[model samples]
Target: MRQAGLTEALSGLDALGRIWRRRGVFAIVAGAVLALAVAALVLLPVRYLATASVIIAEQEPGANTSAAWAQKVGDPADMESQLLVIRSPRLLRQIISSPGVAGAVVSECERGRLLGSTDACQRLKTDVGAFIDHVESRFSVASAGRSRVINISYQSGLPDVAQTLANALTQTFLEDQRTEGANSREVASSWLWQELKQLDQQLREADDKIQKFRRTKGLMRGANAPISSERLTSIGQQLSQAEAARAEAAARLQEIKSEQERGPTDAPSVLQSRTIADLKQQLTTVSAQLASAAGVLGPKHPSILALTREQASIQQRLVEEMQSIAASAQKAFDANTALVNSLKKQMETAKAEAGSATLDEASIESMVRDTEIKRQQYAELYKKASELETERRVLRGSTRLVSLAELPSKPFFPKKIPFLAAGMTLALIFGVGAALLADQLGARLISPPVPVTPEAPAQQVEAPAADEAPAIVPELAESVTAPETATPPPERSSHLPSVADVSILACLPRLKSLREMSALGAILQGHQPLAIPRVLRLASEDTDFQHALRDLVHELGLKRSARSQRIVVTSPDAGDGKTTTACALAEHLAAAGRRVLVVECDVSHPAFAEIMALPASPGWLGALERGTPLRDMILPTAHPSLDVLPIGATTGPVGDILDAISLDGLLAGLDGYDAVIVDTPLPSQRNDFLAGTDWAIVCVRSDRSLIEPAVVTVNRSRALGARDVGIVVTMTDVEHRSPPVVQTAPVAAYAGAG
Candidate 1:
């Protein structure tokens, strides 16, 4: 179905092409339209525009300022924070209040308000939303390409305004950035100071609490020490050893000291005391290092493991050293104590060694030296902590701005030329469509033309020969006469006279003689004589009219006969004009003339009188009706050249009339005739008159028939037969110019008479 539709569409397009070709004016008109369009386009001026670009640099948030949190929140939230600060009432107010910007904005706002309202400054500030709005509005900030740069461009009606706005925007942006940054930095610094101070307080409080806790819990410097089962067990074993050693050393030392206090022998006591003190001090150092290592390197550390190993090694060493020291102390104490004990035992022997008063004062000086060493270590650590805090405070002050916007040099607006072109093009298309629509709706002319064929020519066909009688021909017969003039006379008219009358009068030709008139009228009626045989037939069926017509023909001597009768039988009326006269006249004239004959061709209404008249071997109608030899119709007449015969019975309901072709045969059979008068029916009322004849004369009535009817009768007879003949105009008025004379001539009899 679709394919059929497409085929039809293509056919329609072909037909449309034919239509367009025939109506080539349409194409010319369309071309003219297009040409005018091109002309107009050529006439239009070209326009140019200048452009400039600006970049919007993205300012990343400070590293420690929750930027990661801002990203998870999306750009709008971050941008809103940025936008709020940029478009903040205070900031917008600040821009509006700025040096030059304030006056310009106030003037613009006043102009705007003047165009709208009356309140000045109050309305001005309210309308100065235009400034914030202008930057946020005029400034188009879009992320350009795939980069982090946002493009910010400003456009205005004027290029200078565009440049000014661009510059102003860039300046505003820098100021906004700087102000925001400085404010932000100041706020951040102040916040940092507050927070840092609070945190410091917290730190000091934590330190104080930790210190107080350490002091209250007796955990002084070894607070991080582990007290796992294995370490505790090792510590317990070391403690037990130390305690045992101390107990033994104390026993020895006590014995020595007791001896020193009781008696005066102090060397052994002092040495024992020094050895105990050195051993105890070495043990304390090892214990303290082990605790420190345990605090520094928890239970899982290699250092802790090393500490444990070292502690174990130290425990053994300390035990051995303490035991060795204690043994030496014990020996000294034993020796001194034993000596004292022995002296006590020998009470009197010990009494002599008791002088010990000088030793106590020097020992007091040694105690004071140890107290000085502890105070110096505490002072060093406190000073180091203060320096670290001061460094931290200064590191927070340094901040910098990294991005800046530059001013643009052009506006991005109007685009008037392309817009106008588009509008005009659209308008032209619509105009063409309207023209086509109007053309379709209006009436148009239709042309009429003649048809043509390849085979046939264009001339009109010839009508029938009978119809051709009216058609004019220029020919003459010797038996008749020539036309006196080439053209006919015009009738005179009495109505509105004009020069047409004079032209008509000038073209009329003079009349001719009666004989000439008769002959020429016969010729004009379309009868043409083929040869110049001097015989005539005045043939008709009616006798009286025929007799008169015969006398007229004889007076004219149209034929020659012995009896002086050359009758041309004719009619004044049907059956009234004598057909018998044709026979009688022929018989009378042929007495002196040569052979004469009567031709009978009125087959439908035959009036041969073969029964009434004398019978013959074969009659004229017998020869004609049977289509037999015309020689048989040349029966014996009284005249020589003339012939007389009677018509046969009616062959059919109508006469076998002669036409152009059949007349040829009828006339061909009359080759021997000097005079052959044919008897026929009346032609006016009955059409079988003069069916066959050599020449004919009409037998028209004098009173009853008009000359015009008689003339038409003569014309009609000439049309049917009588190629060379004349009208007798019988029974014409006696006052006519030449009255008819009753005369007869039989040329056949005339030949016989000679």
Candidate 2:
């Protein structure tokens, strides 16, 4: 698991290295994106933002209670509702239609006209709806973070205009709230007044109905009751008096009768009479006189007889008076009895009349109750209407202006520091992404070649004998080198090539001075050999360049079997030192006592004749077309072991001859050489000769050749069946005379192609 993780980490590092190697691409892409961002920032129009705030105070009219004043402020739903109301179309329309607001918008539009925004200016001037829409786009309203305060903002190119519009919007909302409250009260008052009038009419009609009912029923009210009721009471009182009088008279008559039965002298009536009393007095006097006379004249005197007769007469008068008193008592008793009977009959009649009056009074009482209720209702409504009118005059809204907007000193949009920072960050991200894409798309070359660990050995396939395959031309087999000697090659050495030397050569610094080039020329002269070109002769010296070449050969040797090898040297473009590298490698192989063959496959621009210092003659193509013996076209260099087959003078396109005569068959005919180096043109130009080769070395010029084509050449070589592929960076500047330290660690292959 740990090994797997380390491998993954190394893979990631390798990918990043590939990107870093193409830093030039990152710089170009990032620079272009940043420049575009800056241009857009400068060209954009500047806008100023101004804000005004209001505190929403919700309160009931005429309410001074602590509960009402301390009601929870800024209910979330209520605040949201209020915000929506402020941004409502009706309120916005009113704000835009106001004189001050309209003028400010007009001024802004006119300013726009001067600034070449004629279309917008003309549309705003001609269409009021469009003007409103434009203003709405710039206007904004929001609550101030869980508080009752609300913020209204506006954006405009002109700072003063923004401030004016923001303030106007806030003022308009407040006024609208006040006006809405007043209108509500006014409507309520109107309804109350109408209701009161209806109640008044109902009360008057009810009173009239009561009065008319009374008149129709003949129900007249007295102090405490109806008149008929009062009369019934009076008759009852009179009947009671008559009854008492009759009772008293009857008792008197009875007493008088009893007195008559017992004799008139003991009767109460007789005793009460004045005439009886007078007669009694007279009788007393006579009796006294008679008694004296009788005594004096006992025997028959005339004076005594006369006195007795007078007394008798007085007693008779008293008896008649008693009879008269009895008769008067009877008459008075009878009269009282008749009067009581009459009063009783009248009381019965009055009771019947009073019963009818009671029914009528009940109905009148119902109407009177209804009338009273209507009157109370009318009074209540009248009072309420008055209160509503008073309240409407002092109505207040739930919002008040907390602060007016001030003119902004700077634009809200296009903030310099933040805008540039954001732009740069985005540009950098895009640049990195683009660089990675370019690397992935084969637009950049692979990283410096690394020494790969040797894998399982490949099975060696013996080459076919020259006599077994048919040659393209009859003389091709005779042109091949003689067979290898019977002696086996020297044993393999234990010394491994330095990995650091190869890396330094692959990532060389730029050669900036002519002095460096002259120093390189001096080094070339110091290591001269007569048989090879001056450029190829430098490989014999123990320099940094020579060590890089040896490392490359050692790395290739690890991949190949211990047998004859075929190597192809090519480049992504022209003039990348492809020929020099091919010749030098061949010379090195010859110096090591190996028989090597150099075949110049670049027929379009062949350079072997001049490099070999040989006179012009019919090259390989001339010998092929004329069917000349292949052995006659074979040329030898000063090195007896290294030979060359140069591309002769051509009459037409090299592609047609190459297609007609198979190069593979021609190479197969050669059997004796230890190694064959075939130098070809750019991979894009011609790559048919790359197939079936043992190794392909792509030559790249440091700081001059692009990584894109170099990477392309490596991939193409691998695709064309080259058993192994590598890169060599040539023409690189040397910083010092001394070589770099050799690293013993085995290097990894190029991440892109491997």
Candidate 3:
């Protein structure tokens, strides 16, 4: 459904072609608008511009050096800030105060309003601002890409002025920078010298504090801040070594014990002299005891004492071996204890030495830090002194300005071509808009003719045979009356003795013999309504029907009044003989010498150019499009009695170019004209036929046979407040018989008889 609606809308727009075809006046109007716009643009003043550029560089130390390094040295923001200051109001005033620049600007602006007061200086200030504005508007500043070199360019109408201003500003800024650079160097040198004195005093103070602190604390050279971190680390390492030695000794003792339990006979120190000699002495005692016991006892005397003595000798040998083992064990314990104690003592001594050395190292580091601080201060002071000396050397030279500005050769203005083109294009758009407006308003003035067809009545005849049934039945009725209203005086009523029944009756035709009689005197007749002009709108392109209707209205005594006798012919769509019919009807009126105004109301589209062979210039739409008045648009035609108001000043959307109200006003404003014959837009294309028009004659082509459609269109026109409706059949070859005339009694005859 949406697609269908879109299609319909496109179709409606397509239908506008008819309007354009008929709207010749609007074309003229659009052309005029563009032409006028072009003319206006051409009359404007011309302007030419020229530009010049200069490069500024930075000053160097004690020599004519490239500005590249200095330019790079300053921060970009700082440079921009300085540039703004160079272009400051005070600086501008100073520049303009110069005799050369001030006289030139005043001379240049002489054609304009400038320099009239004792405060010409003040006026010059305003002019200077304008000059700066103009220059800035044209001027540009940029640096070479990836380089420190800057280009300052100025543009002006006068080539000489451009060059002069560019050179002058560049020289002025350069000189100013030089002076500023020199002053900066002086200030920097002065500041550095003053700072050097303070710095020297501070250096001495810092040095004295260091020396006094060292002396008061009795600190040795190379002493630094104190901490026991390194000492503790050394102590921890020694302690770890001592623990490993003690663990080794204990493990050896346990291994010896375990081996003895496993039946090892020798002691860890068995080979030593002290343990061996004690073991041998115990053995000798045992042997002596055995010999003494044997001598006291007999050989076979069963003496218990001798046996016990022998056992004792053996036990004594065993006791000697055990005693030797115990002695070796004690020696081994003493040796291991001695070794452990030696390792522990070594560890303690190392810890104490490490701790003391750590403190001394810290103190020495403190002295080294102090010495470095003094060295850094000396170096910074020397560098500052050197920089100050360099700055002083660079500032000793003088600088001078090279150029001054001159009068401008021309003023810079915008190009007029684009502006003119835009204006004309805009006007054309408005013209088309005006056409749409006129179309939508339905203020069209021309109409086509409507065809009329007369219906024939059917005939009836009496039957020839008597037995034939009657075509229609006739019925009779009796009247009833009150008794007091019935009189008894009549003799026939008394014989009947009652009221009579009604009976049906038939009448027969009577024919008389043909006889000729002498005619009586004739009377004068009064004027008929046929004297007035009457227009019949044709529904089809049926020339027969169109002529028949015309004859009918004529014979019916119907006509338009003399003042409003003009008629307009048009159609609802194009290809209808709106123009052709208009020309033909105008030709009819021109034959009678009745002045006619054949106004081409369809300004956007015109068809009358072909019909009338009109000069086709100075059309209505053209005048309107050029923004001219209605009177100027009215042009005389070839025929003396017929003047054509061609369509002109039409473009854009129909709505924008022309207004229905304005068109009506234009028609009403045409009071002096006799009769107007407007060749208007198709009714389907626009409603111009209904715009306060006297009569509308709708024309249709004959072959199309459009009676019912024409009726619908005419009815629609009537609904649109068109009281005077007429139709014309065009492009038709059919013939029509004349309508019968009707007779009426004379009003003058009655008056005379009385």
Give the alpha-carbon lDDT of every model.
0.42, 0.69, 0.49
Candidate 2 lDDT tens digits, 1-754: 1223433454567567767976888888889888988998899888999999988867747635476456545567778888898888788777766656776787887876655656666666557678778888898898888788999999999998999899888888989988988899899999999998888888778777787887887777788888889989999999999899889888878898887787748666567778889999898999999898888886367788788788889988877777777788788889889989999999999999899888888888887887788778888888888888887888777688889999999999888889889889988887888878888666335543334333412122122222211111112122232223212212332122111111111321222223446877756742332333544544344255554554456656722456778888888887777887888777766765678888887866778898887667677788777877655777887878788888888575566454344346567667688888988754343446456677777777644412446555766665555666666666554531122223322221111100
lDDT of 3 by residue, 457-564 (tens): 111112222111111111101222123422222221110011112110111111111122223211111111111011111112223333333332332112334564
Could you tell me which residue pairs clash in candidate 2?
Answer: 445-707, 619-648
Give the best candidate by lDDT. 2
TM-score of candidate 3 to 2 decimals: 0.30
- List where candidate 2 sits over 4 angstroms from the true fold: 1-42, 55-57, 63-85, 113-126, 215-217, 241-336, 424-754
Per-candidate TM-score against the hidden true structure: 0.28, 0.47, 0.30
Q: After superposition, how far is residue 351 of candidate 1 from its true place, in Å?
A: 38
For each candidate, C-alpha RMSD in Å? 40.0, 27.4, 29.8
- How do the residues 329-404 of candidate 1 rate in per-residue lDDT, one tens digit apiece? 7665454444334333433322222222113223333443443443343344344334333433333222122233
lDDT of 2 at 257: 82
Q: Candidate 2 at 730: error in angstroms?
A: 48
Q: Which ten-residue region of model 3 has the weakest summed lDDT?
A: 502-511
**Predicted structure 2, TM vs. truth:** 0.47
Candidate 1 TM-score, C-alpha based: 0.28
